[model samples]
Target: MRTQVAIIGSGPSGLLLGQLLTNAGIENIVLDRVDRNYILGRIRAGVLEQGTVGLLDEAKAGKRMHAEGIVHEGTSLAFNGTHHRIDLKELTGGKTVTIYGQTEVTHDLMDRRSETGGATIYNAKNVQPHGYEGDRPYITYEMEGIEHRIDCDFIVGCDGYHGPSRASVPENAIKTYEKIYPFGWLGVLADVPPVSDELIYANHERGFALCSMRSHTRSRYYIQCPSSDKAEEWSDDGFWDELRRRLPKEQAESLITGASIEKSIAPLRSFVAEPMRFGRLFLAGDAAHIVPPTGAKGLNLAASDVHYLFEGLREFYGEGSSAGIDDYSRRALARVWKAVRFSWSMTMLLHRFPENGEFGQKIQEAELDYLVHSRAASAALAENYVGLPF
Candidate 1:
């Protein structure tokens, strides 16, 4: 059990980091509590920023993704019985987003790993590392209740928010930045065809409604609600009817089918932890930070972190520049803050508060209207949604 690096959590960030490190000719071991994270058909997000496409391409995993992924040049903002289309691709010079689910991305990476198999362990539990200064840093874990140990040089934390990796770092050193939004998103995956060619983000008197898709036959959507709302209580008919009410009146009512196959709720939020690195330990993906899903920044930000770390690690391995690793946290924070700000901005503009009175509602609606018509405002959104150049 000896390797150059030890990666925790095999989710998007962890997997992508493994791929990046592999390209850098650095050997690493991936540890996961789950034995296998196949396509459970979980619905997280379906949008990608313009710049994220390039990063995926460099990984060589973009080959199959580009073929299966749907590209959307524009999205709609429906209000006052009209739909406003934002030409994201046109504004960014063919720089559009792909409507691919997060689950699919994970599956693609897992498949790619088989072709480039390296040190990895599934269902590995009780993983512990000691002696960061030594060449053979010991990593001990349980594989099917059997204790095991492997030595590695450095540890990388990609295990996400709740994993033990964060706790392993010194408590006082981590500065956690977080905000709990007033609302949650009731995400539903349906058997119905898509309601539109592109995503439709609507702000209604009732709540915010999102119309997006999974594939040719599958449809995905979100309805804003209180943090306490539960999907199990929401019947299929009730969900469809409410979606219709929130959707734009002009859109064909026939677009939705009779039933939704699944429904789930996710609390909206914006969070970030400072100093992503601690000695030989480093944080990536949900292990490092989280953002509200409004701007579809979570996965992209994770992708960016791995890319930055991969470059820094390459410098450290090839040029023996520890400076690159030392500055990893600062460099990653620049992009992380950008995503946090965008996600918060989108959440505030779309969701309503219980304290909002009639005048407040009027002001909010006015802002939405302005965002629809104003080129400058739309450009601002375009820049954020497609991602700032990293």
Candidate 2:
């Protein structure tokens, strides 16, 4: 098979990119190692930066999102037994974030692709990109016990951190930076009303906890735990009790407890791979970088990466220009690094570091105090939270 672009992975990045390319009259096919159901089963972060929402609109997948997604003008930060609100819209000139599940985004993209009759091959095993260093690169994969090859002009690796896309790059050609936090987030999805109208991020002596919601009745909550902790070890009552202890008394009192629909522990980490472009093969989303979920930058960063790659490809195909494609890595990395910094800073400011001792805790307290008291600090937090410029 021959196409203009061969995309790997069927996650939001790959689907979004495929949709954009198809809309531009660019022929592309997506290949994923897993089936459609498996892809949508994974739960992920849901906060949407305005830039991400615009991209979804461009992809023609925004109908349900705009209808169901909750708009948050601001977020509350709870520390020292007080809840402080940061006005994201006011601080960022009318900018706000949308609370929509990532699963829903994937479903919408899948529906759009199916309606448009786009090509997406699932259960494609052992997928590999070859000859990307020179022109005429192609992808190879195994399906139903048969090997197949796809000749394409370019290859996009949205296959994520462990996927073949990044593994295809020569080890020496890439530089990696990573930091694993000492703690992980024990998250729960429950069918109960959220405690607050807006998301609440609490920094307490116990740990860090966040109160987020997918809708008015579907709530998602997380509390920091040791990296060694497991979700099964905590019962629903225990999780709720611990979570309440981490928040202010008033916010905790208003909280409603229920049986959890989903529960898991996710380790926190910050990682980035340099030079997202490897000849004709380019990496986007988790394939190139990962940020701690503190500032909710994971999906937003992926959207920005997709935006940069799409622009480059669009310019190349539409204007017969290679400038955008050639500059993709530099531009994407510039924004990626900023998000990495912001997520890292937020993680440091909110989470209690057991190893950091009393001195570190005091420093965190001072930082949070200054952040709520100083307009400049508050605005900076709001800007990063709503998302930095695309």
Candidate 3:
């Protein structure tokens, strides 16, 4: 097979990139190791930055999102038994975030691809990219007990952290930085009305808890737990009990409890691989970096990476220029590092560190206190929350 670009992985990044390129009259094919249903089954963060929404619109996949996604002008931060609201729109000059599940975004993109007859080969086995450094790059994969090869101009690795894309890079050529938090988030999805119209992030003596929702009637909640904790360790009632204790009395009182529809524990980490580009092969999304979910930057960062890569490719194909492609790594990393910093700061400000002890706790309290009282600090938070400019 021959194509202009060969994308590995069918997650949001790969699918979104494919859709965007295809809509622009570019020929591309997506290869994934898993089937379509398995890809859609994974539950992920829902908060959408305005930049991400625009990318989906460019891909013609924003119809369902704009119709069903909830818009939040601001988010609330709770500490010291009080909740303070940060005005996202006011601080960011009319910018706001959309509360739409990542699953729905994937579904929309998948449907659009299907309608347009885009090429996506699912259950592709042993996918590997070869000769990415040369003028011609190609991918090989196994399917239905047969090996196949695809010749392409470029290869994009949207295959995520564990996928073959990053693994294909020589170890010495990449420099990596990572920090694993001492705690993990135990999250639950329930079919009950959210306690608050807007998302609430609480920093209490117990731990950090977040009150988020998929929609008006569906709530997604999370509480910090030990890194070793497992989902089965807590019952529905127990999870609710811990979560309520972490919030202000009023918000807790208004909370509605129900059996959890989905529950899992996700460890927090901040990671980045330097130089996202390796010759003709480029890494996007989870294949390149990971941020703690504290600031809701995971999916947003991926969208930004896609934005950069898409623009670079579009420029190369449209204008016969290599400037954008040549500068892709430096530009993408600049934004990626900022987000990494923001997420790390948020995690430090809100989470309890057993290692930090009394002194650390006092510092966190003082910082949060200043953040609410000072307009400058609040504005900074709001700006990062709404997302930095693409």
Question: Which consecutive 10 residues in model 1 have the weakest lDDT in total?
Answer: 35-44
Instruction: Give the per-residue lDDT digits (tens) of candidate 2, residues 32-68.
Output: 9999999899988799999999999999999999999
The residue-by-residue lDDT of candidate 3 on 235-331, one tens digit each, is 9999999998999999989899999999999999999999999999999999999999999998999999999999999999999998988999999
Residue pairs in clash, model 3 = none
Per-residue accuracy of model 1 over 119-218 as CA lDDT, tens digit each: 5688788876566444455667887778988777678888888887787766788889889888888888888788898888887778888888988789
- TM-score for all predictions? 0.95, 0.99, 0.99
lDDT of each: 0.80, 0.95, 0.94
Deviation (Å) of 300 in candidate 2: 0.4
Show where candidate 2 strays beyond 4 Å: none
Off by over 4 Å in 3: none
How does model 2 fare in lDDT? Answer: 0.95
Write down the TM-score for model 2.
0.99
Ranking by TM-score: 2, 3, 1
